[model samples]
Target: MTDGPIITATGVVKTFGGLRAVDVDKLEIRRNKITALIGPNGAGKTTFFNLLTGFDQVDAGEITLDGQNITGTPPHRLAAKGMVRTFQLTKALAKLSTLENMKLGALHQRGEKFWQALIPGLWTRQERDIEARAEAILQRFNLTHMRDEFAGTMSGGQRKLLEMARALMTDPRVVMLDEPMAGVNPALAQSLLELIKMLPAEGRTVIFVEHNMDVVQEISDWVVVMAEGRIIAQGTPAEIKSNKAVVDAYLGAHHGEDLSKVELA
Candidate 1:
C-alpha cells in the first residue's frame, strides 16, 4: 500500500487577519506512515491541518491527495475523495445517538437523496448495511454499549473514541487527527494510542497534531516541527528529538541556560 507520498503540499499559505498561519514551500506525507506534526502553541500546526483537509481555504499554493489537486475543496467533498479528519475538540453530535452519529459519517448514502427517501426499497437495504457496519466499528472501539445513548452523555474520552470511530465509517485512505488525545483520560489515552498505531496496517496514512512529546516519540514514524507558520525541522523521532531546531522551537534560545542566577520578573 506504500509507494510515494499520499499527500503533497507546495507553496501553501494561509492567513488570519494579518497573521500568516501557514506558509510552507513543500511537504510530503509518506503513504501508510504515521506522521506527527508538532510545535509550540502558535506554530500553525492545526491551521496547516485545516488547509490540507479543506476545513479552511488556502490563500496560496496547492495541495494534492493521491496525485489529485484538492486545494480549496470543501470538507465533505474531501471526505468523499478518501480524506477525512477529526477535530481537536471532538465533533460528536450531542443530540444524536452514537450509532446515528457514526451513520452520518458514511459517504454517498442513498438515504441522503430526497427521491431515494420516498422509495424505501431504494435505501432500506443500504440502511441496514450501514447500521451493521456502524455496529462493527463501535464494537472495535468498545463503544457498542453506548450505541443507542446520546453522544452528549459520553465522557470526553468516549467522545474522542466516538469521533475516531465515526471517521472510520468513511473508510478514508488518509486520516488526519487534530489533537486526538487532548482532554482524554490516561486510560483512554492508552487505548487511543494503540488504535492509532494500527492505522498504517489498515493501509491508511495517519497524520496527527499532538503536543505530547511522549506520545509523539512512541508512535510517530516521522516527525515534522513547525515554528511561526513554517516547518523548522523534520526527521525520524530520534532525529527530531535531538534536532537543534526542534529544541529551539519548543524551548527558544534560552533552552539550556540556567535560571538560578537570573533575577525574578
Candidate 2:
C-alpha cells in the first residue's frame, strides 16, 4: 500500500434506461496491491469496471489513474496509458490463434497503417520483437503448448488464461480483472489465483471483481463491497466479513454461516 491511490473514482454513476446500474460516490484502489470488488448479482461491479476501463460510457463521474483524469477515455487510449482490463466472459477472438490474439494486444504496430503494411522493412523487426515478447508471456502462463491453437478451441479456463496473458501485452501498470475465477475448473482456478496474487509483487496494481469469498480472502489485500448500486463497505477481507452492512446487503442470511461454505455466483 502507498500514501496515494493508484486509481480513484468519485461521484460515478451509470444507468441503463430505467435501471441505475452504478452509483459510486468514492472509491480508491491502493498502489501495487490486490483489491477485490465483491457484490451480489446486479450490484454493478462489472458496470463499474466497464466505466473505469472506458469499455462503456458513464452517465456521470470522474476517474483518474495515477492522478491523471481519464474519464471517458477510449479503451485503446487507456491501454496506451498503462491501464488494461480483462473481461469476465473472456474476450479472446475465437478465429485467431492464441499467439495471434496476444500479438493484437501490443500497441502501436507500424504494420497496422495501410501505407506501412506494404513496407516490410518498416515493421518486420518490430513485429519479430513483439512476437518474441508474446511468446515469453505465453511461457509464463504455461500456454506455450497452445500458442498455435485457435482460442475458440480452448476450454473455458484456458480462455481465461489467454485473456490475462494478452492483457499483459500492454505492460500495464494497473490491471483490472472482472470475475476472474468464474467458470474456471478447480485445477486451473488455483493456478489463476496464484498468478493474480503475484501481480502486485511485480509492481502492478490489481483490482478484480470476484463473487467467491474464499478466493477473495485468499488473494485480496483490500476488499470493497457493493449492493443496490452503492458501495456498502470497504476493508480487509476479515473486516469485510464482519461488516454488518455487508452482511445485511450482500451476505444476506449467511451472516453467521462459514464463508468457506458460502458459494457466490
Candidate 3:
C-alpha cells in the first residue's frame, strides 16, 4: 500500500432537482484499511458512493483514485483501473452459471472481442486460465460447489458472495461494497463480515456502507458518519461512539440512548 490516501474527494456535490443529495468538501480514504460509511436512511451515504463509483455524475468537484482524476469515469473503466464496486442489491446474472458469471468479471479476455471470439484457438488457453482463477476464488469464498449451478438458484447470501468474488477477478485495489450484510441471514452475514475483514490483509482497501454498528465496530479502522447530505463526524470506532454529533443525528431527543441498538433512521 502507498503512504497516503488511496482515494480522495474534493468539493464534491450532487443534487437531485433542488435538493442536494451529496455535498462534501473533502474526504480521504486511507490505504489498506477498512473504512465504514454510516448514516441514517437518506443520509446521502449511497449517493456519495454512487458519485465516487461513477454510477452517477458529480454536479461539482474532483474525485481521484490513487492521485488520478476520476470524477466522471464510468464503472467499467474504473474496474479496469483497479477500482471496483458491488451493488446494494446482488447483481449476479440470474441465467448464467456461477462460473460463467465469474469469467465475465475477468478483464481483457481475448474472447470478449468479436473476431477473436470466433476463433477458439486464439483464446482457448486464456479461457482456461480464467476458469482456473475463477475456481480458486470460488473455493476461497466457499462457493466451489455452486460453480455449475445457475445464479438464480442460489440463496440471497450466496448470490452476494458471488458478486464479491467476481469483483476480485478485476484484482481491484479498492473494493466498495454497498449494504453487503443487508437482507442476509445472521450466519451468512457473519461469514461475509469475516471475508470483508480479510481484504486489507490481502492488500485491498475497503469502503463499505452499512447500518450495523456492531459490524462497523468489529471491522472498521475508521468510521465516517453523515447526515442530511454532509459528513458530520469521522473518527475511530471508539471516538465515534462518544461523538455527540453522531448521537444526535441518530437519536435527536434521546441523547443517552445506546447508539448501536437504535436503528439509524
Candidate 4:
C-alpha cells in the first residue's frame, strides 16, 4: 500500500518583477521521507521553499499538506498546523537562553490563550512536562551543556542545531529546512548531517535545500533538481550522479568544470 504525500505542490509559480524565481511543475514530499531540493546558484530552490512555507504568496498553483489546501497560509498559521521551517540563515533568539528559546516553540504545542497567560494554573500544569521535553530534545541534539547559556554565545553550528531542536518542540509533522548546511564548518556540518539522518528515524518528514552534493547524497532519500527557476532533473543520489541534464547544469561544455572524479562522498 502506498501512502499519500505529506506535502504536494503542483504548477507552482512565483515572479519577482521581471524574474520568475520558481516554476516547478510538480514536487512531492512523501510521508516520513527525506527529500532534497538541489541546484546550482540561482536555481530557484529557495523561492520554491518560500512558496511552500507561505513566506511568500504563490502566483498560481496549489499546495496541499496532509489533505488540506494550504496554498497561501501565513507562516505563523502553518507553524500551528504542524508544519515548521528553519531558514538557511540560523535564527536563534539572540537574547533568549537556549532552553527558554525552545520553550517559545512549545507555546504552539497545546494552548496559547490570553486567559491562560493571565491564569497561573492553566499553563503551570504543563510547565514541568514542557521543561522535561525541552531538556530531552536539547540532550538529543547534544546541546544539553548549553541549555542555560544565552543563544547568542553559541557557535554557528550550535545555533543551527538549536533551531532544529526548537522546531521539534512543536512536534511538527513536516520540517522544511532551507540550506541547513550552508556556511557551517565541516565538523559541525557532519553533526548536522547525522541529525538530519536521525529525523527520518523519528518519523518526521524532512525536506531541505542544499548545495553540498555529499551532504545531499548522505541525507536525502529523493532529490529534486532545479535550475533557472525550473526543475530540470530529479532522482536518487546514484541516478542524479549520472544524469546528463544535472551534469550539464552543473558543469556545462564552456565551463570546463570536471566533476567526474569529484565524488560527493
Each model's RMSD to truth, in Å?
A: 5.0, 4.8, 4.2, 4.4
lDDT of 1: 0.91
Backbone clashes in candidate 4 total 0
Q: In candidate 1, which residue pairs get closer than 3 Å at backbone N, Cα or C atoms, i.e. clash?
A: none
lDDT winner between 1 and 4, please give it.
Answer: 1
Backbone collision count in every prediction?
0, 0, 0, 0
Lowest summed lDDT window (length 10), candidate 2: 256-265
**Model 4 CA RMSD to the hidden true structure, in angstroms:** 4.4
Judging by TM-score, tell me the better candidate of 2 and 4: 2
Better of 3 and 4 by lDDT: 3
True lDDT of residue 191, candidate 2: 93
Top candidate, metric lDDT: 3
* Model 3, runs deviating above 4 Å: 253-265
Residue-level lDDT tens digits of model 2 in 1-265: 2569999999999999888789989998999999999988888899999999999998898999999999999998999999999999889899999999999999999998999999999999999999999999999899999999999999999999999999999899999999889999999999999899889878899999999999999999999988767787889999988876777666466654433344432
What digit string (tens of lDDT, one per residue) describes model 3 on residues 97-207?
999999999999999999999999999999999999999999989999999999999999999999999999988999999998888899988988999999999999999
Ranking by TM-score: 3, 1, 2, 4
Which of 2 and 3 is the better model by TM-score? Answer: 3
Question: How high is each candidate's TM-score?
Answer: 0.94, 0.92, 0.94, 0.91
lDDT to native, each model: 0.91, 0.90, 0.91, 0.85
As a TM-score, model 1 comes out at: 0.94
> Lowest lDDT 10-mer window, candidate 3?
256-265
